[model samples]
Every structure is written in C-alpha cells, then in structure tokens.
Target: MKQPKGVFVTGIGTEVGKTVTAALLVRTLKADYWKPVQSGDLNHTDTMKVRKWAGEAAGTFHPERYRLNLPMSPHASAADDGVTIQLQDFELPDTRNFLIVEGAGGLHVPLNDQDCIIDLIQRLGLPVVLVSRHYLGSINHTLLSVEALRHRGISIAGLIFNGDPHPSTESIIEKMTGLQPLFQLGEMQALNDECFERQVQRVGQACKTLLDGL
Candidate 1:
C-alpha cells in the first residue's frame, strides 16, 4: 500500500497554539489527525478539538498510543500512569488520506528517559510544519527549535505563525532561519466552523505546494 502523505506539527513551546495550527492544516489538507501521545485533558483532547474544528474535511481521528491523565509532560504523566512510552509504540495510522500528526509540547518534550518528541518526529520520517506564536522569548525558542531540527537533518515543510504577526520579530526569525511563513493565522475571536472555514479559505492555498511536494 502507498504510504500516506503527512507533516508533523510541533510548536516552540507548550500552549503555543499547536492544536489550532494542526486543525488548520487538517482543514486545509483534508487530512487525518493523530496525536500519538496525549498528556492529559482527556475530556477535551487535541484530537477532539481538531475533529470539531477541521469539520467534515478531516479524515479519521486516529487513537492515541498513550493517554496519560495528568496535564504534564508526557514522561511524567506516563510514569504516573505506570506506562513506559517507547519509540516502537508509535506507528502511523492506516490511512490513504493525508495525515497531520500533532506533537505534545515542544521538540524537547520527553516521552521517556532516552527519547523526545523530536525523536518521535525523526522516527516517523515526516517533514515538520512548526507553529510559532509571538512572545517575549519566542525568537530564542523558535530559533533553537529550528536549529535542533536542522541538526537532526529533519526537513521542515515550513513555519506557521499562529496568532497576530509581529513584523520585526517575524522578519528577524525569517532572516535568521531562512524560513518564510507558509501562512499566518490571525487571532480569532472564537473557535467555530466560521473561524476555521474562513481560515481555510484564506491560507489553504499557501499549503497546496507543500501538499503537492509531499
């Protein structure tokens, strides 16, 4: 069978709008969404959010390999739940449709003593679509993330700025990283079909080349 086309979605740090970015990618690509490891908020998992926001365009919602109840780092949560997350535990879901894999926290987020989210991304062999939200120290964080991925020789599909754009900050990041924004998503007043669909209409075309290359 042909492997599905996909990209891994990661952020500079936690709560940096990775979920929102992933949802946008899902809607744009009309892909399947999967979070291999969820470290809490089982009541409102990222999978649920993406499924709701991505609307009918989203394909299957793949089950997480590990669901830890505490809303902490995956390693700690897995330990609390008496689970040991291994690299081998993650296998891409069977889907002919494109797959959008969302990561927990940042690249350095630990899944076990030896492996991290970046390791999992490397293992999966998918290019990354990094989500970066502007903040005081975001430049440092975003650069470090790009550096790490480059060090690993991982392909970065492109960058996505999740909220309002900061021109100076964005310019510097682009100059330094040499990565232009695949698209920028403005702040939304609410999360609804209208918001998602509008975003899809605005930025969906920017992703076409990435999808085509995949």
Candidate 2:
C-alpha cells in the first residue's frame, strides 16, 4: 500500500461536524485516525461515532491518547481531572500511510496552560482540513481560522463546509479567501445505522475527490 500523508482536521467551533467530517476523510483515504486529546466524553460517544462512520470495529479504532471526563476545553478538563495535557504525550504512528489528527475545538482553544490547539497542530506539522458550518458568521470564522493557520505556517489542504444552508457563502468564501469549499455536507435528519452508512458513503466519495490532489 502507498503511504498516506498526515492531515489535521479542525473546525471553527464545536458542533461543526468536525469528527463526522474527519471520519469521512479517514474512511475515504482508508487511513489511520487519532484524537490526541478528547474532552467531555462521558462514555466515549464522540470516538464511537467516528469509529462507526469510518466503518471500523472497536479493535481497529485507535484510542485517544488523552481522554478527559469534563466536557470543556482541554485545559479545564485536565484541571478538573487533576491531570495536565501535554503535547509530548501525543504520538503518531510513523508507519501509517496517512494519519488524521482531529482537534477538540476551534483554533486557539486552550489545550494547556501555555499551549493552545494551534500549538498542537503546529507541533504535528501536518496540513489542515478545516470544517465550517453554513450558518451566519461562518465567513468570519472560516477566514480567521484560515488566516491563523497560515500565520502558524501550517498548510491548509482545503475546507469542508459542513451543513451549508446557503449557496452564496460557498462562492463568497472561495472568492474572498481563495480557499475552496471542498465539500458541503447536506442535512441529515437522523443518524441511525442506515443513515450513518449512507452518510459515510456519500462523504467518502466526496472526500476521495476533494483530497485527490493532496
């Protein structure tokens, strides 16, 4: 098999479908996925959702290196758990064809006392795939996020417009920011087994095409 390039999946904010989009990318690339630090996972719901989306069994799913019970920023969660989140603790398998590292929240989210999420992404030194919603303020959030990544010297693979309701923002973002909206995931009323399978398949195909150049 060919070696896969590493891609970091991040979002403008929470509930922007970062994990779902990351799972679609992973399933499309048939690559390894890792979330270095996960917060607010009462019963590992987010990880499990990604696993199911990637069509991987529990054994195949890679566990997060740091799992915090608190549903807040890594800094807060770690503090609540009486532990510290360290970038040094996160490790990537060097042998995998491609590794997808998913962030917990938007850029600048505090991971520790001194470092934020962008610091972690910079540490990984991987290209980014930002996921944004289609609602208002997306333009501001997306542009700022992209600018922040560039300022940190991180390459952006592309953007995924998750839950884009208005079609105008698509062209607007591309024109203003020069970052193409790779995929605009439509609405899904339910996430049942059948819907999940369909969603994965659709996103998988779209990701394969969007990520072809990378």
Candidate 3:
C-alpha cells in the first residue's frame, strides 16, 4: 500500500489550539497521531483527548517517550528529570498512511540543549500545518513563522485559524500574506456532543478539501 502523507502541526504559541486542530485533522483523515514530546502532563493528556474525540482504537495514538513532570519547555522539563531529549529517540511507526505529528509548542520550542522543534520537523521533512489564533499580532507571528519554515526549506501545507469566530483576522491574513486559511475553528469551551459533531463535520470537510489538492 502507498504510504500516507505526513503533516506536522505546530502553533504560534502554547494554548493556540494545536492539539484540537490536530485531533480534528487526524479524525478527519482517520490517520495516526503522534505526540513526539509531552511535558507537564503525566499520562499523555492531549493524546488521550484526541483519541477519545477521534473514536480511535486503543493503539491508534502514539505517546512521546519523554514525558516530564514540569509544564515547561521540553528542554527544561527534561533537565529537571536528568534526561536529554535526543533526536534518535524520536521514532514513528512505519505505517502506510498519513501521520499527524503534533509539536509541543511553537517552532522555536527547545526540545533539548542543541535542538529545537524546527530541527525535528526539518529532519522529518513533513509538510507543516501551522495553527495560529485569529487575534492581534497573528499576521506578524504567522509571517515570521512561514519565513522561518521557508528558511529551513520546509513545506507548509497551509494555515489553520484556530478560534477565529469572526473573519476580521482571516481577511487580513489572506490579504497580507497570501496564505490560504485552511480552516477556521470556532471557539469551544467544552467538548460537548454538539460541539464535537460540528467540529467533526467541519474538519472532515476541510480534510477533503486539503486532500483533494494532493
């Protein structure tokens, strides 16, 4: 079977909705989701949440090897535990399907003393799905992030505007940057049945649109 294309999901900053967006993407495609490095959570909170949302089987999600007690940068959390996050330690299952690798934080997040999240993505050579909030300063942050990815020769599939209830910021981003807004995830305080169903439909449509281009 042909291998599925891989997509890396990174955010402008923490709480920018990377996990939720990733969950949506994976559920839409019914693809494997990988959380490469998790800190601050003891039992892979995001992975578990995504699995539940996706209705994935028990083994569909892969947890990162490095799980730190502190809710800080992977580097800092690893240091506190006297462990170093090594690139070689990062591995994904060899499956013939799309894999969504969710980054811990923004592009520049330090994974270890010598390497950052960008380094890992570059090494993986996976196209990125940037997740940014539709708020002030989003344009600057998104542009800089896109430029950085370009500098590293990374391919960006597109951008996902998380929590953009209004189209004000989306219009500006498209007009100014020329990057297509792949999805406009609405605000969800809780993952109720109604919200989950809506999210699933929206994400499923977005996935169809994205994959149609491929």
* Best prediction by TM-score: 1
- Candidate 2: list runs displaced more than 4 Å: 1-4, 56-59, 200-205
Please give, for residues 1-214, the per-residue lDDT of candidate 3 as tens digits: 4444778999887889998888778777878888888898776578877887766522367756677889999999999999889988766657776788899889999988899999999877788999988667877888788888989999888788887465776777678768888878888878754576678776777778777665
Model 1 ranges with Cα > 4 A deviation:
none
Q: Rank the candidates by TM-score, best first.
A: 1, 3, 2
TM-score of 2: 0.88
Q: Return whichever of 2 and 3 wins on TM-score.
A: 3
TM-score against truth, every candidate: 0.98, 0.88, 0.90
Cα shift from native, residue 190, model 2 (Å): 2.1
Q: Write one digit per residue (lDDT tens) for candidate 1, span 1-214.
A: 5566899999999999999989988988888999999999999999999999999988889999999999999999999999899999888888988899999999999999999999999999899999999999999999999999999999999898878879999999999999989998899989999988888899878989788766
Q: How large is the C-alpha RMSD of every model relative to the true structure?
A: 0.9, 2.7, 2.2
Query: lDDT of model 1 at residue 68?
Result: 96
Model 3 scores worst on lDDT over the 10 consecutive residues at: 54-63
Q: Count the backbone clashes (under 3 Å) in each candidate.
A: 0, 3, 1
Error of 1 at 208 (Å): 0.8
Q: State the lDDT of candidate 2 residue by residue for 24-121, as single tens digits.
A: 66666777777888898667666677777777522235678888898989899999999988888766655546677789889999988899989988
